[model samples]
Target: MPGLDYFSFAEMWSPLFLVFMLLIATLYAFVVGPWRQRFGGVEAVPVVRQLAFYGAMLLLYLVHGGPLSLLGHLMFTFHMTDMAISYIIVPPLLLYGIPGWLWKWAFGRAFWKPFRLFANPLFGLFAFNLLFSFYHMPDVHDWVMTHYVIHGFFYALLLVVALLNWWHVMCPVPEWSRVTSLRKLGYIFANGLLLTPACVLIIFAPEPLFAVYNDPQVWVQAMGYCVSGDPARLLEQFEGPAFFNLMSGREDQQLGGIVMKLLQEFVNIWALYSVFMQWYRKEKSQEDDPAFDHAASGRLNNV
Candidate 1:
């Protein structure tokens, strides 16, 4: 296999993006630490939450601007791995990491009230899954990959909806959470169900569905988004995406689908376990409450 070392420095590490991400981390530290009082933060953010936030940023940099981003362009499987990490894993971590006070400060305004409709669990659930499925449609995927501006805008939009979708599952602000614990489990299941069809289509296709992976001309055009030079030169230098791919196009596509499905299932199972444990703990606490014990004794005596 051709190593990523063959790629240019900018292509592999994306120094500018790394700097931008570092700046974001620095700003988060200031806002949550020094500027907490100014931002209406009454208490310090938890250490665990801060770590989660930093971890999410690291994952974001890895998939979006790191070597994985370059590899994604070369192979369908890597692309799907990026997608799973970006949308499935990263959003919840980000939501968990930020302080509730920060979230409230950012979105508590009257101006945001109207837009809060977009945060509805049902709206987020359906909109994100639908848009995600639509994006994977062979023609749509090819088109988005080739158009730089559209590609950027659409992916940003997707990330926004992904955050919205996960907000229900891991709403940072407890008081502001709309979905109940039981309902959240249902929501997670529905998300898994909704995403299955897109994975199924990709996995079961008899041949490669995406022209960007199979056709050298189309691959070069799509490579324009990541590679700095004239994309046509990619054809001259490396032959095509196949030059980088270790597997046949069909095998790569199938593996990509399986990877996506498995990652989604793993995340969902973890979510289910987390929610169930939370519910169990809450129930146990209620059962052990002194008030509850008195009330139960009274009821038994009356009976």
Candidate 2:
């Protein structure tokens, strides 16, 4: 119910409290559930990993979505970068690193049917991409940037798509659905390819695209009043009010794009390696076993 703003986020009730809730939920899931069962009765992820991950995510929210978000509202480059990474990269990695069962228990039942539909290969991939692309269009992007509810919904939808996309590549339930190692590798690379054009456009575009990028009032509305210069001066250099000249925006947006692409490549390489090793081992085992085909056939039919 609290709004998204610098003081609001810094005030302990907004992002800080939201982060605490996330920690509590994660702790409960790991400690009371999987971690408890897995490690004899004790429950704790390696303290270092959990702490580091949460710390980074918290800092990121503070920097990008908090005070910095205000500055970005004035600057086209910063805003673009903020939207790209906050929506595309950070959430998925954070979610993926989380123990799978915890997420399953949290959103598993209530959102199960929709989650599955979204996770479906055909439905999930294209729909999220379409929506993501459309949301970034100038008018729609400006609208979402201007409205609180729309912004929150856009971020939430992006996270859902991220979850589904990752699930297809790293499935926890093999019985429900699965892709071969080669296929998983292929899927990741394909994702990389699909997201590439947008990154290129953002990085290489000759000038700003959205109205918020050029107008001060719109930029302020989009970013929440965090700019560094006189509103008039900032508007003078550019045709409009976009934090048009800030290196921060250029650095942030470009780096975010690079990070997204690189992160995808890293995960994909790992997945490819894993799949290849698994398949090679499986194939070798079959070669040594005379009854492998019959056993495989039986398993296939059961599925």
Candidate 3:
């Protein structure tokens, strides 16, 4: 890990994204808290919703704007960790954080027809997995990591699709809901299945799959996206990623893939449980209805 410390930026922390996150939280507060009457009918956003939004912003900064971002550039394992948080965790948080009224206002507008189409359960499932799988192709992955703009664009797309996918399940806004209670299980399971092949490809590769992670030259070039403050210093002192505990480059890559798949499984299972419980409760409530009791009694009297 000694050589890997070169990628650490404890000495020179970048606060650009910290500032940006704060600005976003502040703007949201203004729009949702004080200026609500001016902008829309939403005058009082719930405190919990505010907390969710702020939490997501802070997590985003920690992952992308903080030292963890540096680690991601240095190692593929950290990179996949970054992806899990950004796409898997953050999107649902964002969906839950924003008020349903806000979503309704947006969806009620003229352009929501297309939004509804894209955010449909089936479409989100297919589109996100397809884009995600394509992104992992070694050549495509290498090119993306090496170019900062494309890297940002690709990740941004991932986040958008992630949001769309989760919205089908959470559907915080009532109008845009696609999947019914039972169908949610199928939707979530299908997503995990689609995502599994990509992880398996990385996990079972006989050799390292990503050159940006395995090849020192390719790694350094991609590293430039994070370690922007000092190129010459890095040139003189750069060493490849550390594979601790007798792990080789391929082993490290496989570990990353394993971690990605594990996180996905955990999230999907939690979602399935949540959806199933909600469905179960609704069915139980219907059975407990006074109308249902009266109907059963009438049938018994006939007997």
Best by lDDT: 1
**Model 1 Cα lDDT, one tens digit per residue, 62-145:** 988998888888899999999999999999989988889888899988998878789889999999999999999999999999
Minimum summed lDDT over a 10-residue window in model 3 is located at 237-246
Better of 2 and 3 by lDDT: 3
User: lDDT per model, in order?
Assistant: 0.91, 0.58, 0.79
lDDT of 1 at 165: 94
Q: Mark the regions of model 2 whose C-alpha exceeds 4 Å error after superposition.
A: 1-60, 63-77, 80-84, 91-95, 103-115, 225-244, 247-303
Error of 1 at 74 (Å): 0.4
TM-score (C-alpha) between model 3 and the true structure = 0.88
Local accuracy of candidate 2 as per-residue lDDT tens digits, 109-160: 7657855555667565566666666776668888988787878778778766
Candidate 1 backbone collisions, by pair: none
Best by TM-score: 1
Cα error, residue 173 of model 1, in Å, equals 0.8
Q: Please give the clash total of every predicted structure, in order.
A: 0, 4, 0
